[model samples]
Target: MSALHFSRVVIVGVGLIGGSLALSLKRAGVVGTVVGVGRSAASLEKAKSLGVIDEIASLEDAARGASLIVLCAPVAQNFALLHALEPHLEPGTIVTDAGSTKSDVIMAAKTALGDKVAQFVPAHPIAGRELSGVEAALNDLYLGKKVVLCPLQENARTDVAAVRAMWESTGADCHVMSAVQHDAVFAAVSHLPHLLAFALVAQLVNAEDAALKLDFAGGGFRDFTRIAGSSPEMWRDICIANKEALLREIDTYEKVLAHLKTQIKEGDAEGLERVFTRASGARQKWGTARAAVTNVEP
Candidate 1:
């Protein structure tokens, strides 16, 4: 189906992801009437004022007639949203999400939605920054980014394709994967990195001479810990939800850190050089690829 076919787009949770999706869909002319639904009246008002949606809708009302319902809320609230909207959702309506984690979400949909699970397509757009809320939303947030869709075995191909088309309308490339694989890969690349950043920043903040150290922090320090500034509540839910995979990743990281410490303590310059060189080269390659795809001038 063409992206333009989705006439009524309902976005739950008018935060950064939801608000941005609403705006982008309208801009692309993929949606006729965009509806914002959330518990926060203030935020819903903000989204409406910003023209993020054509109207503000109650959760039940939003799902009643929506052709596409996008859950852009925190992973913790997904189950509740599903339960509340399941009874109201029209048959053949497509439901998708922008939640970071997917396994629990898929499980929730299965349990709460039953047969409606076939109409649901689980997706995570691998984009966004530390900042959040509708105020921080950018129209081009998903431009040239990768969006992973975790489709269950029972999901209809037409529904999955429709979800893909919606995301592609905003210039995102969609990739398909199983929910388990998605959780495992993100646990290492996304979740683990956030944990490390939070830990590193927390250690420094709790130090006896924190003020002195903070005063001397440079660009590297700022860059390394930038993600530590993300919403604690959101990250907390993610850590708990993906505990098993995250814990394994953490253990592996600890071993690597131990090896690096041994090399440093022993004054093994060769060992340090080899490790740093490989890490630096890999980062450089990744940066080049990102720059090329995003058309970043620098």
Candidate 2:
């Protein structure tokens, strides 16, 4: 397939996702210029030095001239940035985002951009490292990953196509879904998992033998709690933004946990084994299928 090209692309946040997108586009020679806008001049300068951006500009200034604008900031921050970019966004400019949740972002775009919401595509790339910031960005970070695009009712076909093409150029497989569905799915798979990991670590910290227990923790703890080391601010925003769906998932998980607790307390080894065996088999099957479908190297 021929690569999609853009004359100019403005990235509102020069952090991990935004920087990686800029690097990927530049490496593919699919974008002419990438202008970065951020609240931190130091971070912007670092992004420029890393060659993830061609220059730095105010969000309004950058949005005015770009063929595409990508918002990679936290969910809450995107609201203000979207409002600021509304007046400056041209008719042909396609605006998209790399937020974790879609429903909230779609709502923000509607409230902030009004009629210009037609050009806005809410996207979430299902890929990331535990580390963040521009320094951790990689050109191939999104290669073979999944990107979900939740298009608004006002979005034109051409605009949606352009957004898909942009992510495709970054080597992502794009899928389309309704905003409500996207949020619900991600809340169960991504948001709730992160919350669980964070909660596990918090529980450990509150334990009387916290320090000694952590000191003796093995690979199991490390593997399970890895995401607990993720950006607190970003996860905080996502959890709150998708609180409704996340709460539902949490409730479901709690019921399952209570069932397991009851089995253990009653010394029902058969029941415990049945539950563990079922979960273990399902996890193994999912791992194999996900690897096959995504072609992601382990």
The candidate scoring highest on lDDT is 2
TM for candidate 1 is: 0.95
Give all candidates' CA lDDT scores: 0.88, 0.91
Models 1 onward score TM values of 0.95, 0.97
**lDDT tens string, model 2, 109-211?**
9999998888898899988888999999999998988999988778888888998888888899999988889989999989999999999999999999999
Candidate 1, residue 46: the lDDT equals: 85
Candidate 2, TM-score vs. the true structure? 0.97
Question: CA RMSD for every model?
Answer: 1.7, 1.5
